[model samples]
Each structure stands twice: as structure tokens, then as C-alpha cells.
Target chain A: MTTLSLGAARAGVELRSFWRERDAVVFTFALPAVLLTLLGSLFSGVYEGSTVTSAQYLVPSMIAAGVASTTFVNLGIGIATDRDNGTLKRLRGLPMPPLAYLMGKVLLVLAVTFAEVLLLLAIGMVLFDLPLPASAARWLTLGWVFALGVVACSLMGVAASALPRSARSAAAVLNLPYVVLGFISGIYYTPIGALPDWVIQLGSVFPLKWMAQGFRSAFLPDTVLPQEVVPSWEHGRTALVLAAWCIGGLVLCLMTFGRRSRQTS
Target chain B: MTDHAVRVRGLRKSYRDTVAVDGLDLDIAVGEVRALLGPNGAGKTTTVEILEGHRSRDGGSVSVLGVDPARGGSSWRREIGIVLQATDDAGELTVAEMIRHVARYFPRPRGLDETLSLVGLESKRDSRIRRLSGGQRRRLDVALGIVGRPRLLFLDEPTTGFDPEARRQFWSTVRALDTTVLLTTHYLDEAEALADQVTVIAGGRVVAEGAPDTLGSRDVATVSWRDGREQTDDPAAVVARLTAAYGGPVPGLSVTRPSLEDVYLDLIGVPR
Candidate 1:
């Protein structure tokens, strides 16, 4: 339908707006890389007899970290600011298709997430000589994880857009969850499975844990970690958990968006 | 001529315990510019929002271009243009890019260059929205609104914060548009200049509706001269008599009807 195309076009516009901002692009891409390097260097020798380079472990974690930073923190704050500045109100008045507006945001988040993934993967390959997945299937699994991670994180960002009363407060609140999730899910350290039993269990309940797990399956070989813990890259569970997160996040975002629209109306 | 751009009867909306628009009725014909003049919180913006299909009314029979705006589809939205009070300025997109991007939403949109020229921003098309002056940004808002070639345009205080020269330029732009325009503003001068018919709303109801010159309908005219002023029912007779008494054309003399602002302020009641 023409309406659908228009909607997609609008989403394209939103995506372009994000890409045009140098500071936002730098923060989204560079910050995660910088943090990965710092954490990798700091924890280079924490575990004995561990063949995994800190950068190797950190690369996979940064995929999850990238989503949290870009999709959740960056997007959540940007949307809240849009709402506060009457941008949303203005858009609502246009001849724009409703789906187009939302699709634009989704496209933007997806593009940024993809870019982050690629950048992190490049850093791993060149700087740390991280091994490529041995087979096409392994690479396919990695792509699914990254794609689903983006969806889950973007949904969380949309839901979080409703929490803050202003742009400044929204940025602060969005950052807290991202930092907490990054630390808990092992984006800057070893997998949560290596932590205490309760910590791993708690982390598993969140999307970050499964996201990191999925990324780890792609980058690390079967010989690297305990078989029982890594489980030889279970594609089924990775797809299911990440899909569930995407759906749950979308539902929450829709509910919050509807509520906010009604309240403001 | 048969199509009414906007038609509403008994429109009502409430916010919690407060009633914002109560039993308001309006009928705007095609190609007519109607100004809704009122004090702040007189339900002008609320009424406009309802007509724009952005808000729901508690009770009403309302039609915009023969469709209930509350349930109007995307096709209906394409026919309406809304110039909001503010818009997104944080994006680094150039003015031309922003206009062209938004223009794609409509089935038939004005040319980008033409729209920019109409709003007097042709030279600044390459400038980022954030880099624009306040007046230039306001012009950009107008450019976006008209870019879609909407059949009906809703302008909510479009000239607020504009300098006098820019305001005059804006007035010309409004005059040039053939579409029906429904404007809400506290500026009586703006209403007088741009509106073909004026409706004064006070306390959520239409207090007066007529041509700007005759709203109060007082036959009495005020005749002023260098010495003093007097109110008379017959200004022509008074002027004729004055000419005879002065032995020539009356010196420094003028006859004035009550301005729209005077009638509006009087109807709304001047602050104590």
C-alpha cells in the first residue's frame, strides 16, 4: 500500500537524522569500542589458564553492549527529547502513516545496531585476531543473534522513552539500566555463568544474558569453555529467548506508547 | 461551494474534572479564512486539535471534509495541513532535505523550491534547521504545512514570536494560499488582516461572529479632531456641519468605527 511505503519513508528519514549527527554516531560506535578495550586490558590476566584473550571475550560482550548503549540509551533519550520539544505532536498532525513513524525509528535502531556489530567484529578480527566461525551455519547463528538483540534492545528503548519526564532525566535513567545490564550480562567481563550461581540465574532472566550467550557461541570454539555451560551453540534456544524478548519488549512499548498518547490527548 | 471544510455541533471535551471545550459549534466553508480569536484557555487550541483529528471529543457531531476526523483514515489526513506551534529542530538535516522528506507523505505535494520561496527561505534551504533564526524556523513550519497542498490548513498562532516585517510577509503567504484556513490567535491585528470572517470566543463559546468592521454593530461613530472627540450616530452629517462651521473642509478630522480589538476586548470584558 502507498501508506505503508510512506511509513517506511518516514522511518528512513528518522534513521537519516540519526546518522547525520556526528556526536551521536561517535558515541554509539566509539564508546562501546573504548569500553571494550579498557575492560579487556584491565581484566587481561584475571583468570589463569584461560586461552581466551580479553578482547575475544570482550568483543562478543560488546555486541550486547552496543545494543544497550545505542538502542536503549541513545534512542530512549532522543525520543523523550522529541516528545518534550513538540516534535511528536507535530508529526502526529502530518499526513504521515502511523506505522511509518514507528518504522522509521525501528529502521534507525536497526541500522545503528548493525553498524555497531560490524565495527566491533572488525576490531576483533584486526586487533585481537579473533577466530571467525568455522562454518556458514555458525555465521548464520551469529547474524540471528545480532538481529534479535537489536529488536529486543530497540523495544526496551521505546518502552523506556515513557519513563522520564524530560530529556535530561530520560538520558540519566536510560544510562543506568544500560550500565547495569552491561555489567551483569558480562559485556565487560567473563560470562555470568562464571559468576556465582544466583548471579547467573538472575542475569539469565534479562535479554542481555542470552544476547551475550548467543554472541559467545559465534566467536568462541567448542574447546574454549565448559560444554555444559556453552552447550555447543543451541540455535533453537537462542532464537526462542531472543524472539520472546523482542515480542515482550514490543508489547511493553506499545502499551506505554498508547498510554502516553491517551494521557497527552 | 456545497462542501464545508469543517462542521461541528455540540462538541465537548473534558480533562478530569475540568471541561475544556463545552458545547462548541462551528461551520467553516471551503476557501474561507476564519480566525478564532480568544484569550488563552478559551478552548481555541483544543477545538483545533479535535478538528485536526489528533484528539477525541466527548460528545459531538463533527465533520471535516465530510468525514468524522475522529475516525478519518490516512486519505483524510492527506487533505489537511497543520502548522504546529513548534517542530523538531535538533536534527542536522538541511531545510531542503527536511521539506522534501515530509513532502513525500502526500499524494500530491508542492514543489520544494516553490514552497521554500513562498516561506521566504529559498536562500536558507541548505541551512540546518537548528541553525535557523526563530523567524526562519517559523517560516519553515509554514513551508512544511503548505508543501502537502492540503485542502484545509489549521494554523495555531502561526505568527507568534515573528517580527513585524516577517509577520507581514507571513500574511501575504496566507493570503496567497487558496485552501481553507482556520486560524486561532490572540493577536487581533493578525485576525483583522488575514481573516475574511472573525469569530470571537470567550469562556469556551462564540461571543461574536461577523466581518471585522461590523461585529459590535454600533451605529455610533467616533469623530475626532485636533480639539476633541465626540460620538455621533450620524458621522457624515457631523462632518458636513463641521465643514460649514470651519468655512472649508474640516481640519484634522476623521470618523472611526470601533475596531475589532475594541469589540473583542469589550465582549470578553477588559481586566479590572
Candidate 2:
């Protein structure tokens, strides 16, 4: 069989293992949507001079965070667990190309992230009355942003997997930055304009901030534009930043992966 | 071109300041089951890992299946299967499912049913791997290892955690595989039971390499009679003389050669 086909088979196995862990599957799929519902209901007001409720504003922000959760956080913890449990070592010894193992993981994340995004969108539409993109241009923007965001975040996730010393500590190691990034990136607290300038600058240095901004542009209207930290959605810069992260993250992943002897064999 | 399944000379590896494998040499012919016997930290694992291509040796000329492991690519990897010690991954996958998942990596793989029976996991084919007992799980490990029908298999202390019964069962599973195997273990009886040739290493070097029974001194044998015991090269002659002197079967007469364990202890410089 071809290497790519082996990767596809590996993805099938990954998906099976992931889904069979019933609690993790439910929790992973439910966390962002649950938070959206609770936070959406708790923060009950429209932004000043705009009809878009705070809940509606949160929908897109949460979607971006949702993407990160599925790709970055999920992949990071999964890879670390694999490393700890001897999955990586076993795969390393196999005829499977190292690329195939990576491809399988990325494919798993892609599948899960799509499902996560759709779930969040469904909740936003039904519960918060958020509108889907009505324009082909908005849809196009959404596509590229989602694509680039997944690629960049997934690569970063693979790189980050090498940070945690073991599977037991992987959750804490990967999630701390994820939660902190959400706050500073305005996913947890929005109308990005409300945050301090330094916070905005710091948040902008990361991909989550740009991803949340891109999604906000796709979901929110021109009326909410001034509420953003920037007056307009910096589409070009968003693309540039996410693309740059993709390259940088790829390099980091290459540097860190296949390294020997962190865990006792 | 060589028919040896593995060949190594001066294989060395160190962890920072600690030398793990220092100038180790190994040779195993095709279809031979060679056991590497050593104490902990004697570089057995380091040597095996280097040969498996999972580790890089600091210095060595190593070839596995006619390819240098450090440079071994996917095709080279296909010819070898590895069962690592204490692998706890893929718990959520079922016995058959896990085997099938790995089988796809090889260009040609054993049939699912055939592989399952080979490792004696057919009864647990649909059971989750996590639910398997230790012995059964180990069988599954072997199932995954040999599913590709590799020409060479590396079993790194394959029966380390097994109970006596489980170890016996696992030995049979391994014995069923018609492939060259390089196993690492500290168990003398396990080495004697499974290995066609045993190589004992200490301090990262081969201390002795030969058939298990004759590893240390093939010439010496011990003869014990009711009246006396003596160590001599000609035990048959000693036994005959004792029987003739007694004018019947010599009372309490027993002839013994050095056991593999005795030889192993002597080889490793452990007094008994």
C-alpha cells in the first residue's frame, strides 16, 4: 500500500480510539458549546449602538477558540499521551513513514475540528440568533481563515506536544496557555477594544487573536467594526499572520519531533 | 552480502556523561533466536534500540537485515518487527482492530485471522486491549509485532512482567514465529528455553556467546557418588570406576554438567 493510504488507515484507528473513549469524546465536543451557552446567557446585553447581542459577538470568538481546542489542545495532549504510552515508539519502528503518522494525527484533528465548528455554529444560530455569512465574499474569508487557522494551530499543537514531560502532565501544560490565550485574545471577553493596548498587542502576536478577528468579520456586521480593537478587519494581516504561524510552527514541529529518550523506554 | 540477520561491531552509546553501550559486538544468523542476557544498565536495551533504529549509536558499524539501522528507511523497517517492553498504548483498540491498523503499514501482511491465531489472541479478537489480562495483552503485543511477517523481530524483554504460567505461554507464542529474533532479557531460564544461542553481556560488552548449556566450560563435569564427589573432564570414566568399585549401580551417583544459570553467573562475574 501507498504511504498516504497507510496514513488514512492510521487516521481510522485514531478516530476509533478517540470516539471509544466516550467521556472524553462528549467532553471535548461539549466544553466550548457549554461555555458558550452559560457565558452567552450570563452576559446579556447588546454592544453600545449596535443590535448584535454580547452572546452573538461571543459566538464567533468562541468558534475560533473552539478551533484551537480541537486542533491545538487536542493534538498536543494526544501526541504527548502517545509518546508516554509507547505509541510513538511503536510507530517509529514500523514501516509507516513518520509523515504518515503525522498525517494521520492532523487528519484526525481536522475531522474533529470540523465537527466542533459545526456544533458551535449550530448553537450560535439556534440559541443566540447569529446569522451565517450571507455573502460569497464573507464565506470565502471564512474558508481561508478556517483552513489557515487549523493548519497553523495543528502544527503548533504538534510542536507543543514535545513540551510536556509526560502524558499525565500534558493537559495542564497545553491548557494553561490555551486558556490564557483565550482571555488575552478576547475570546472570553470581547469587543476587543475594551482590552488594554498592551494586551491587544500581546494577543495579536498569536494566531488565536487573528483567527477570532477573522471569524468576527465573517459572522458580525459592519456596524460592529468600530468595537474591534482595529477599525477594520485586517484580512490581509490576518492571512499573513496565520500563514506565518503555519510556516513557523512547521519548523518547530520538525525540530522537536522524533527526538529520542524523554520517557523511559 | 551476508546471510546474518544482524551484525554489529564496536557499537557505542552514551547518555551525556554516562556510557550505556560501550564497544558491544553482536552477530545473529538468519532464523536464529539470539537472546542477549545482561543485568540492568548493561546496555542490552541500548543495543537493541540502536539496532531497531529507534536510537542512534554514538559509535558502531551496525547492519540489520543488510541495512545500517541508523539509515534504515521505511522499506528496511518493514523487514523488522519490534515488541518493546511494557508497551501500554492502543488500549482503546480491540485485539483485531489494533492488529489490522498496524498490518496496513506493510506491503504484504498476514491475514487478520492468521495473525490473530499466531499470537493466540483469536479468542480476544473483539475485546478491547485494555481489558486483556497481562499475558493476553502481551500476546497482543506479539500479534502486532509479527502481523507483517517480518524477516527479523526484536523482542525487548518480551516476558518481563509475566507470571510463570504466562511466561511459558508467551514462550510458545514466540516459538511459533518462524523468523529471526533478537530478544533481550535477564532471565537465564528464559534465555535457555527460547534462544538457539545466548550472548551474555556485562559492562556494555559481550562476556560470553555460545549455546546456553556450554557457554562457560564444555569440558568440565561433576560426578557425585555416595563416598565422594569430584570435578573432572572425564565424568564417564569416573562414573564407571565408581560403579566397578561398588560392584553395582553406584549409590547416590549423579553426573552433572554446568547448567546455563551456573555458566551465566560465572560469565557475569557473580559468585554462587
User: Candidate 1 - CAPRI tier?
Assistant: medium
Shift in Å, residue A158, candidate 2: 1.5
Residue lDDT tens for model 2, B1-272: 48899999999899999999889888899999999998888889888888988778889899999999989998898888999888889999988889888888888899999998887877899999999998898888888889899999988888877899999989998898899999998788999899999999899999999887778885589999778899998988998888789988899989889888878788888887
TM-score per candidate, in order? 0.90, 0.93
Clashing pairs in 2: none
Worst 10 residues of 1 chain B by lDDT: B211-220
Query: For candidate 1, lDDT tens digit of each residue in A1-265?
Result: 4767876776667777777776566666678888776666666542334567666777787867887777887778878877887778877887666677777777777677777878777777887777887788778878888788878878888888898888658757777887777766656657544666666667667888788888787877765565224535566887888899899998998899779767765
Where does candidate 1 chain A have its weakest 10-residue lDDT segment?
A224-233
Native contacts present in each candidate (fraction): 0.61, 0.92
> What TM-score does chain A reach in every model?
0.88, 0.95
Q: On a 0 to 1 DockQ scale, where is model 2?
A: 0.72
